[model samples]
Target: MELDRISNLENDITQKIFSYLSIKEAARTSVLSKNWSHKWIVPPCLVFDDENGLSTETIVSHVLLLHNGPIDSFKLSSRKDLDPNDIDQWIHYLSINSIKEIIVKKRNRYSSSYSISSNLFSCQDLTHLELYNCLLQPPSTLKGFGMLKSLHIRRVTVTRDVLEEVISHSPLLEKIILCKLGIRHLKIDAPNVSFLELRGGFEDVELENTINLVEVSIDQKRGSTNSSSLLKFFFKLPRIERLTLQDSFLEGANGSLPKKLPEPCLCLNFLSISIRLNNLEDISTAMCLLRSSPALQELEISVQQDQHVADAAEVTGWLNDKQNRPFTQLRILKVTGFSCVKAEMDFIVFLLLSSPALQQLEISFGRKAVEVVDFSWIYDNQNNGAFMQLRLVKVTGLSGSKAQANFIRILLSSTSTTLERLTLQPAASAKELWELFKLLGEFINRVSVPAVVLEFLDPSNSVQESDDSSSSSDSDDDIGF
Candidate 1:
C-alpha cells in the first residue's frame, strides 16, 4: 500500500516534500518503501536553503549524490555563515549538470566575500542567471552561454570590458539588471534587448549599437560628475517607447549642460521623471527632454523638496507655448509631493491649459498649509471647449487646511458638470469622509451629471508606516516617482 501511494505521487508532490525536509529526512524517505528508495535520484528540480539546520557542505554533498539527470532549475542559498569556496563548488557542479536556470543568494551577513569562476559563464544550457554579492571575473572570451536570455547581478565587482564581451556574445538576450556594481562603462551590442534597468553610483553606460529597445528605467547617481555622460548614452537608444529617469543631476560643476539630449523619434506615449537640481540650467536640461518627447500621453513628474520651481522657468516656458508645446494628445497627468509654490503651480497650470484632451488630473500636496490658487480662470479662458472634456480630479494627502479646502471647492464649482470621479486621501475619519461625500453629492445633483464618486483613500491605512523611518538620504535619481 505504501509503495502504491509513493508511485501515485507526482514529481511536483515529491519535490514539495523534498523542499521542506532536511537531507536526513529526505534520505530517510528512501526507507519508506522500495519504490520510494530511488525516486529521489532524478527529481526535476533541486533547492537547498541552509535555513533548516543543514550544513552547507552536507547539503552540497547530498545534492551531488542525488542529482543524476539534467537539472531543469537549481536554487542554492545559505542563511548561515558559509565559505566562499562552498558556493563556487556548488555553482561549478550545477554548470556541469547543464542546469537551465540557476539562482544563488547569500544572506547579507557581516560583509562576506564570494567569487565566481569564469568557466561558469560557459554553461551552454543556462538561460537565466542571478547572483547577489558574488565577485565575478570576466571570461577570457565570451565562448558559451549562447542561450542566456536574462542576467541580474547585484553588488558585484564587474569590469567594463567583461560586461561588453558578455553583451556582444548574448545575441538573444532580452533583459539585464545591474545594481551597485563596480562596472564603470557598459556598451550593449545586443539589438534585440527589450528591457534594461541600471542602478548604481557613477557608472557610465556607453552603448555602441542602436537597440530595438522598448522600455528603460535609469536611476542615476546623484552629485556625480559623470551624470551628463550617463544621460547621453541613455538617450541615444533609437526606438525607446517608455523612459523613466529618477533622482538624476543634469548640470555640471560650472552649470554647463550636456551637448545633446536623448531623442527617440518614435512618439513617446508614456514618461515618468523626477528631477533634482539647485540651478536653472538643470531645469533647461529637463525641458529639453520633455520637448523632445512629442507623443507623450501619460506623464508623471516628482520634484524633490529642495528643488525650487523658480529655477525651472525654462521648462515652464516651453510648456506654456500653446502653439509649439501643446499637449494635444495628453490624457492623464499625476504630480506627487507638490508644494504649490509659484514655479510648481505655474508649471502644472501651464500643462493643464495646454493639454486640451486631458481627462484625469491627480496631485498630492506635501505640506500642511497653503494659499489657495483658484483654477476657475481656466474654465473662463478655455478654448476649443477643452474644459468640457475634463472628467476626473483627485487630490491626496489633504490636511483640511482652508487653502486646500477652498481649492477643492473651486474645482467642484468649475468642472462639476463633466467631473465623474473625485478621490481624496488621508481624510481624518470615515465620518468626515461621509460628510464630505454628502456635500459633494448634493453639488453634483444640482449639476445634472452622474453622481460624483467620492472615495477616501486613507493614507494612514494604505501608506506603510515602516517606510517612514527609512531615510531618503540615498540618491533619489533611480526612483523617478
Candidate 2:
C-alpha cells in the first residue's frame, strides 16, 4: 500500500542523492527495493579499485555496458591482473562518455607500466589528470586539455617535449605536481599555473613566464644541479606566497648567494625550510629565505638530526647580525630536530627576540623516542624579550635538565604579559615531567595574566608518524597533492 517514493524519484535527483555513496555501498542498497535494484543509478564518480578481490576487467566492462549517461571521474587503481589492452578500450569508452577526470595508478606484475594510448587524449572533457607509473606518448594531434586545472604526474615516463606540450596546452591549469620525473631539464612556461610542487632532479628549470605562479615547493631528490643561482631562480617567483625547500636545493645556492634578493618575495606569507644547524651555508641559506620573506606570517625550520652540531659559542657571534629582520609580521614559528645543544638554543633565542609580533612557538626535537637525560647544556644567560605578543608555547622531546627547566622558567617569567598555554611532551614516558615542574617551584601557576593552560602530552607524540609516505609511490595519503 506504501508508495516507493525514493525509487519513483527522477533520475537527476537519484544521481544527486546516490552520488555520495561509494559504488559498493550503493550496490548494497539494492536489497532495499526491487525497483531500485532493476534501475540502479550509479554515481558519476567510478573508482574501480582492484585492491580487493574484485575483477576490474569484467566489472568495468559490465558497468559501462549497463550504465547510461556521462562518467565524470574514473580511477583505475591496479595492483595486479590489469591487462594493458583493457586500458585502451576503457579509455576509449570513457572518452565518448565525456569523462572529466582520469587517475590511472598502474602497478602490474605482468608489465612494467601501462602505455597510455591515444584514446585518453580524446576525452576533451577531462579537467583533472593524474598518472603514476605509466608511459605517455603525446599524440601528434594532441589538442591538449583546454579545461584542465590540475595535472599530477609522478614516476611517469613522458618525454620533456610531451610534458611541456601538456603543460603549455593546458591554458587553465592552476596546480602542477611532479615527482621523480627523472627528467634532467624542465622548462615551465605556463601562463596560469599557480601552484607547483616539483621534486626529484631537475638540471635546469625555466620559469620566466610563470608570472601568475603563487605557491612553489621544490625538493631536489638528488644533489643540487649547480646550474641556477638563487638570485636568478627566486627573481622569477616574485609573487610566491608559500615556499618549501628540502634536501640540497638551497645548500650552496649553486655557488654564492647575495646578501639579499634585489627584489624580495614581497607576497611570501609562509615558509618551511630544511637545514643543517652546523653547516654555515645551510644556515646562511635558511636566514636568506627568512630575511627575504618580509610578509612571512608562519615558518617551519627542520634541522638535519643525528649530527654533531657546533657549539653555539662558535656560531652565535656570526648569527648575531640580526639577519632575521623584517619578520615583524611573523606570528607562528616551528622548529624540529632541535637537540638541546647550545647552537639550537642560540638560534631559538635569537629568533625569539627578533620577532616582536611573534605569537606562537612550537619546538620538537629528538633523534629517538627515549627519555631525555640532562645533556648538561650551558648557555650564556640573557634576558628574554618582553614577548608581549607571545601567547602559546609548546615544547616536545624536551630533555628534563635544570638547564632546560631554566629555559622554560625564563620564557614563563617573561611572557607574563600575554602567555596563555604551555604544552610539554617529554622525550619518552619520563617521570621527569613531575621533576621538571618541581624544579620550576610554584612559578608555573604564577602567570599574572588569565589562567595559563598546562598540558603534558604523551612522549610518543614527540616521535612523528614513522610512515615514510613521501617516498611511497603507491600511498594515496596525500590525495590532494
Candidate 3:
C-alpha cells in the first residue's frame, strides 16, 4: 500500500513503467537507486521535442550513442535551425537499429525546411512515416518502401514522378494524406490504398489503379486555376463509398455539368458538399452530383455566406425538371448556414417531395430571413402522403413569425406517428440567441403531435466549440499513423 514500494517490483515491470516517462524524467530515476543507474539508457521508443532546454541534435545524439535496444518508434521535432547533417546521422543510426515508425515535424513556418535524408529510406522495417514542412527527394537507387502501410506528407516538396514511384513501389500501402503541397499533377498507381485525402490543387490527378479505395476527400485551393482536372480526377477513381468536397474545389466546377450525367455511382453511400452559395450555379452543380449518386444514403451541405442572393426564378426552373425525382435511397440530409431565401426554401421543399425514403432532415439557419418563404407546399405534399415515413426534423435559428411556426406545427402533426425528435439550434450573436430563447415557449405551446419531443440547442457556445473540435480532430488524424 506504500508508494515507496513501487521500486520493489520486478526489473521488467519497473522498466515498463519508466518507458512512459520522458528521457530526462527516466534519467532522474537514477538518483532513487543504483539499480536504475544506466537503466534509462535504452527503453525502446525515443521521442525528442522542444520541452528540454537542450537542442534536438544534442539530445538525439546523446541518446543514440548510449542506447542499446531496438527502437520501435522514433520522433524528432525541432525548429528550422537544427543541423541537417546531424539529422541525417540520426536517421542513419535508426536504420541500423531497425526503427519501425518515424515522425519528423518542423515547428517553425517561416524558417527553411530540411530536405529528408535519403539514408532513412533504407529502413526496410519502417511501416509508418509522417513528415511536415520538409523536402522529399527519394534516392535514385530507390527500391520503394517494402513494408510501409501509412504515409502522411504535409507542406512537403516532391515531384509527381517521385510520389508515383513511392506509391507504386509500396505493395502494402493503405492510407495516405497529402496537404498544402507544391505540385501541379498527381498520378497514383497504388493497388492497396483504401483511404486517400488531397487538400491542395493540382493540374491533374490520374488514378491509374486504386481498386480498393473506400474513402476519398478533396479540398482544393480557393479559386484554383486547375479546377478542370478535379472532375476528371473524380471520374477516374474506382467507385469510393464516401466523398467530401470543399467549396474551394466546387467553385471551379460551378455550372460545368456535363451534357449527360456521369455514370451512376452505385457504390457511393455518403456525400458531403460545402458551397458558398454565390449563385444558382453552385446549387445546380451540387444537384448534378446528387442525381449521379442515386444510392447515396447521407448528404451534408454547408452554405457559406455570399453577398449575392439566389435567383429564385432561375432556381425554380432548374428544380422543376421531372428527371430530378427519385432520390429513392436517400435517408438523411444535413444543411448548415441556411438563410431563409425564397430559392433556398424551394430547394428544401423539392427535397421533401423527392426524397420519399428520407428519415431525417437537419437544418441550421441564420439570424434573420431576407424574406418569408411560402412553404404551403409542405402542407400540399403532406396531404398527398409524401412525408408519411419521415421520422426526425431539426430546424435551427427558428423565425418568430407565425407562418414559420405553423410550418413546424403542421410538419409534426402530419408525421406524428413516425416523428420522434425535433431539435432547434438558434443563430449566433447574443441578441438573436436571447430572442430565440424567449420565443421558445410560444412555439412549444402550439405543438399538438403526440409523443413528439421538442428540443432547443444553445448554439452560442456549441457552434464555435464544434468547429474547433473538428479542426483539432483532423489535425490528430493527420498524425494518427
Maximum-TM-score candidate: 2
* Alpha carbon lDDT of each predicted model: 0.64, 0.73, 0.72
Give the deviation of candidate 1 from the true structure as CA RMSD. 5.7
List TM-score per model, in order.
0.77, 0.87, 0.82
Clashes of each: 5, 0, 0
Q: Lowest-scoring 10 consecutive residues by lDDT in candidate 2?
A: 465-474
Superior candidate under lDDT, 2 versus 3: 2
lDDT score for candidate 3 against the true structure = 0.72
The residue pairs that clash in candidate 2, if any, are none
Model 1 over residues 1-481: C-alpha lDDT tens digits? 3347766788778878876665556767888777788766666566666656757677677667666666777766665556767666766777777888887766552366577766587577888887766677855666636888888776777777776777778777888877777666667777668888777565567666646777877766556545656666655666777877666544331243442344543556887776433245555676666666767788877655442434444544544563346767789998766655545655666677677798998877654343546544333333323355678888876655544554566567657668888888853422344444555566667767556777767666533211111112232222210
Shift of residue 298 alpha carbon in model 2, Å: 1.3
Top candidate when judged by lDDT against the true structure: 2
What tens-digit string does per-residue lDDT give for candidate 3 at 1-481?
Answer: 5565655668678768776777778778878876677778867777777667776677789989998777888887666367779989988998998888999887565678788899978999889998888889977988778999999888888887888888889889999888778776788888889988887666677887788888888776556655656687667655789998865566678656764356766788999877755466677677778878878999887665556766656667777774356788999988766655556656766777788899998876654454555665444434544466788888865545544555555566557678888787655653444444444455456655557777877756445323211222334222421
lDDT of 2 by residue, 343-433 (tens): 6666777787788889999987554443335343333633554566789999877767665677787777778667889888887645556
Local error of candidate 3 at 124, Å? Answer: 1.4
**What are the runs in model 3 whose C-alpha is more than 4 Å off?**
1-5, 8-43, 51-54, 322-324, 365-388, 393-417, 424-434, 455-481
> What's the lDDT for residue 35 in model 2?
67
